[model samples]
Target: MELVSGLFLSKRIVYKNGTPVPLSVITKSFEELFNIKLGDCYKKHESVISRKPTKLTEFLDELRKFIIEERENKGYR
Candidate 1:
């Protein structure tokens, strides 16, 4: 028997400015925040989606924290 799973992929990032950030930018930000090679975050997200059931909000919240931490670490004003 084949087990089917629902894979969650972020279609887009909806910013507070009511703008839809492009996938390219989201991917790039993730890379910068995590200090990972370009495209690594996308691969990791895909792997997580395949392994578990994750909510979109939960994922975004975690990503938000990472972004904030990265900025603080970089001393971004």
Candidate 2:
């Protein structure tokens, strides 16, 4: 949820028409795709922004670590 929120906030993604995607649409797509109910994405985004140390990117940091480790293990570096 944090990652999705970050992506939305960053404006790194958009519709083909070059318009920003709504947060609700993004969150809803993620929920349906993952088959997981994410209650109150706005609150989750608030928590993510308030996270200490990582400062709104805690989940992304963890994801980067895991990806790096996997790539190293697979000799993809």
Candidate 3:
């Protein structure tokens, strides 16, 4: 993934707690890892908001959806 505006430029995926979750999971598993808060959100602009301690699986799922939608937006078959 690419960085839109903050320190969360990239993330990796791996397993944890006998669960195959993305490395992003660490954002919550170890909040201290990034000096971020769980479920804490930031308002970038009046109409824009960003998230910290983001969940990995959620990120990937959304990323996939975005990519697909982008493709469709660009008239992909």
Clashes of 1: 0
Global lDDT of each candidate: 0.52, 0.83, 0.44
What does candidate 2's lDDT look like per residue over 1-77, in tens digits? 78788779988778999998888788889999999998888887777777787466766889999999999999996
Which segments of candidate 2 are over 4 A away from where they belong? none
Give residue 10's error in model 2 in angstroms: 1.8
Worst 10 residues of 1 by lDDT: 1-10
Clashes of 2: 0
Candidate 3 per-residue lDDT over residues 1-77, each given as its tens digit: 22221223232333455444433444455456656554432222111223343543455568789999999999998
Q: How close is candidate 3 to the true structure, as a TM-score?
A: 0.29
Top lDDT model: 2
Error of 3 at 25 (Å): 17
Clashes of 3: 0
After superposition, the stretches of candidate 3 with alpha carbons farther than 4 Å from their true spots are 1-56
Q: Write the per-residue lDDT of candidate 1 for residues 1-77, one digit (tens) a residue.
A: 00011111233356788576554566676557778665454555555455544553455567789999999999996
The lDDT of model 1 is 0.52
